[model samples]
Target: MKQREFLKKEKEDIRILMKFAGIYCRENHSGEKVPFAFKLFDIKKIERKEIALCSECTRLLTYGLTMRLKCPHDPKPMCKKCETQCYHSAYKAKIREVMKFSGMYLIKHGRVDMLYHYFK
Candidate 1:
């Protein structure tokens, strides 16, 4: 796929993920809504990135695999949020590579189930 097409899909995925994250946060954080700052970050004027991660896993729950899901080794391992933010800067690259590999594999094997299984 062209870069533009991939970016469009990525943006849509980010939006959907942000919505889900917002809902989850509101339910968990004392029934208090998550602030806008927490929902999405503007990586660029045209591109946005969702910073959603499970409080426990710190895993990126929104995008297929993105920079946000890193295990940062912060001083306070006691804090769930801090634990999630530890920087594995390579996480995004790893995820992108895996996704690209899967795409190529799917083109050859044509199995939708592969994607479904991973998402599930």
Candidate 2:
């Protein structure tokens, strides 16, 4: 894929994961959305999604986006099926929990289009 396409895909994936993590966090935890926006956050290019998420989930999102931003793949494969894992073990486990939870939630809610690519 072209660089633009790759970037777009990365952004979309981030949005979906963030939304899913937000869903899980909202149901499983208690916290607030910090209103302060930082200048260094790279996710501005993607819309600032306004979902309410806990601080931990918020941190997970920052980590997740950072991982995506540094991805070495030209046309990235699904992270689950990738041969090389870039994330630290703790992060990998945490993200896997989030993804699995959100994947099932998405399937239950009929968001099959996203799953088609990820779970294929």
lDDT of each: 0.39, 0.70
Which candidate number maximizes lDDT?
A: 2
For residue 83, give model 1's deviation from the true position in Å.
24
Candidate 2 local accuracy as lDDT? 0.70
lDDT of 2 by residue, 67-90 (tens): 776789978887777888888888
Runs of candidate 2 exceeding 4 Å displacement: 1-6, 35-44
Candidate 1 accuracy as lDDT: 0.39
Best by TM-score: 2
Q: How far is candidate 1 from the true structure (C-alpha RMSD, Å)?
A: 13.3
Tens digits of per-residue lDDT for model 1, 1-120: 112223443454444434444434433434323224323334333335433333421343324224332323422242224546443456445444445554455556676554442343
